[model samples]
Target chain A: MKGLLIKDFRLMKSQINFFIILTAVTVVLAVFSDNPSFVPGYLPFVMSVFALSTISYDEFNNSSAFLFTLPVSRTGYALEKYCLSLILGAGSWLFALAVTTVSGMIKGTAVFSETAAAALIILPFLFISVAVMLPVQLKFGGEKGRIILMIIFGAVFLIFVTALKTGEAIGNDIQAISNPLSGVNLKALFAGAFIAGAASLLISMKISCSVMNKKEF
Target chain B: MIKTENLQKRYGNFNLNCSFEVKKGCITGLVGQNGAGKTTVFKALLGLIYPDGGKAEIFGKNITDFTPEDKEKIGAALSDSGFSEYLTVKDIIPILKALYKSFDEKFFIRQGEKLGLPLNKKIKEFSTGMKAKLKILVAVSHKASLLILDEPTAGLDVVARDELLEILREYMEEDENRAILISSHISGDLESLCDDIYMIHNGKIVLHEDTDVILSDYAIIKVTEEQFKSLDKQYILRVKKEPFGYVCLTDQKAFYAENYPEAVIENGSADKVITMIIRGQEA
Candidate 1:
């Protein structure tokens, strides 16, 4: 598993410059706009997508076949991908948080509250994105997998737009929706989201393992 | 050290059923043309693909049941598969070190340098010969008990091929328990290196024989039509008609030489043997 991780890290190194430039640009935009939430909100998604790039690299030149020849199991390989995703996602999230907090401190702005809120919302989405995309990538590989992902996300976007339009047509009674959640415990809501995210990841890992096991080459 | 019994796999029109063994302390060669099912056999043994029937075993354990520890004993260099092109030789060393308990980092690096593999260059940047050499170096560096090399000498020049074979020979000399199951289109390499050789045709093992027996005993006799008609046919395994005469493949070289003193006899080379076996008519 360590070997697999090391190989992925090296493969990902080529994109390091791009990531650094993107991070700097995001941080600069956040500082200038006085919207520190933007950094934490977007960084996790970028990192999660980069994590998937490693999979593409593995599939390139049929390297995955050779990879299995090493002392690694199909289950272990699936688990390692999940672990690497989480590590990269969490690392990017924390880096964004630190940058936002420090820049806010220097500028004398109250950024922690906004950053924390954004983290809570985006972190779960990051986990879910990785959880969902992994099995698709493992099953279809890079080219076809990307096409499937695009179609799925396109459908999701259409559905979200439709829901928003319906809410507007219904006269946008925001208070009525908030009323039912007014007494809900924030801690419990966050815990539930975390549990759901963890469950999604575990299920994804199982599916990836099965896909890998059945995969030829 | 490795064995396959009635191993089978089928795709639409092609069916692969091959069985062969590589004993401890010996180098076994699989010789075949493209699409002859040599890769299928290798993949089955490595558990890269599930066999539809029969079993493949390494060190007496079924391939499907191999744990990480069990797999650690194997080092393979597959022709159509390899490390990501983005990785450099330096980047791969640590990964190999962590994966194989007995991986020798120093030796790997030294061998890489010796083979002219640039340490910092990505694998994609290397030429085909360099890539081939690198793969062999990686496979041999870990001191594996079994080495499965497919077309390891494909792109190498004669000098490089000889050097690589020497390295393999030295590796085997280090441990009598070690074994190698290799395949190459270069019959000369197999003829010199393998203790035993298996020839596959279409999707079946057509021939398997000891290298010594093949080189020492096998012969091809060129005889006139009259001579061929009068010659005893019991010793002939395969026969091919040519414009000049009849070409006969026989293992009883001495019998033909003594009985038909006027017949032209040539020692069987691997290439000649394969051609005759694959294309000749059964005697």
Candidate 2:
């Protein structure tokens, strides 16, 4: 498992420069913009997707076949991917939090409170995104996997646009439908999201392991 | 060290049903043409692909029941499978060290340098020969009891191939308990390296013989049409028509030498033996 992790980190070495540049640009934008939510929101999404890139690298030359010949099991391989995803996602989130907090302090802006609250909301979303994407990438591999991801995101975007247009057409009636949710307890919502994310991750891991075991390579 | 019992896999038109063994202290060779199921056999033994209706075992344990400790005894270099091309030799050293308990980092680097493989360059940047050499080097650098090499000399030049074979010889010499199973299309390499060889044609084992028996006892009898008509057919294993005469493959070289003094005879090498077996009419 350590060897597998080292291999993945080495694979990610080529993307280090790109990650650094992107993080810098996002931090700068967040610092200059009034809405600090951009850094927290974008960091989770980007970092979670970074895990899929490692899978792409592994599939590039059919390296997975060779990997199985090593002292690694299919179950272990699936678990390692999940662990690596958690490491990258949490690391990115913490880095974004630190940068936002420090920059807000230096600029004498009261953005830390808002950033922390936004992080709580973004954390579960990151978990769900990675939990769903990992298995898809493992199942379809590089080219087809990316194509599937694009289609999924495109459908989501279409749905979001249609919902916004429908709400605009409905005007005050849309607020009335959302009014009931305003009274929902914040702690309960967070707890529910956390539980759902955890469940999804576990189920995703199980599915990925089964998929790996069935793969012929 | 390795055994397969009626191992079977079907891929539409191609079906593999092979059974063979590689005992400790010797090298076994698998020789075949393209799409002849050599790689499939290797994958089955390594547990990279599950066999549909057979059993493969290494060191007396079924492949599916093998633990990481069991895998640590194997060093494999499979064709069409490798590390990510983006990884450098330097990057691979640490990973290998972490994976194999008996990995010799110093020896691996030394061997890589001796083979002219660049340490810092990505695998994709290397030439085909260099890549082949690197894969074999990694397989041999660890303290493994069994080495499974699929076409390890495919891209190597003659001198490099000789060098790699010499290294394999030394590896075997170092431990009596060690065994090697290598596959190649180049019959001469296997002829020189293997103690026993198995010939596969269209996913079936057509012939298996000791190297010594193949080189010394196997013979191709060249005879004219008239001569072939009178020649005894009992000794003929396979026969093919040639432009000038008939080429008959026979295992009874002594019988022909004693009885048919006028008949021309040539010692059978692996290539000739495989050709006669796969392409010739069975007796």
**TM of each candidate vs. truth:** 0.97, 0.96
Give the alpha carbon lDDT tens digit for every residue of B194-250 in model 1: 999999988899999998888988999999999999999998999999999999999
Range of the 10 consecutive residues with the lowest summed lDDT in candidate 1 chain B: B184-193
**Clashing pairs in model 1, backbone N/Cα/C closer than 3 A:** none
**Recovered fraction of real interface contacts per model:** 0.90, 0.85
Residue range A1-217, candidate 1, lDDT tens digits: 9999999898888988998898888789667865667788788788878778899999999999998888999889988988888898899888888888788878888557766776777777788899999999889998899999999899999998887778778987657667777789977878888888888998889899999899999
Off by over 4 Å in 2: A161-174
Instruction: Report the number of the highest-DockQ candidate.
Output: 1
In candidate 1, which residue ranges exceed 4 Å CA deviation? A111-114, A171-175
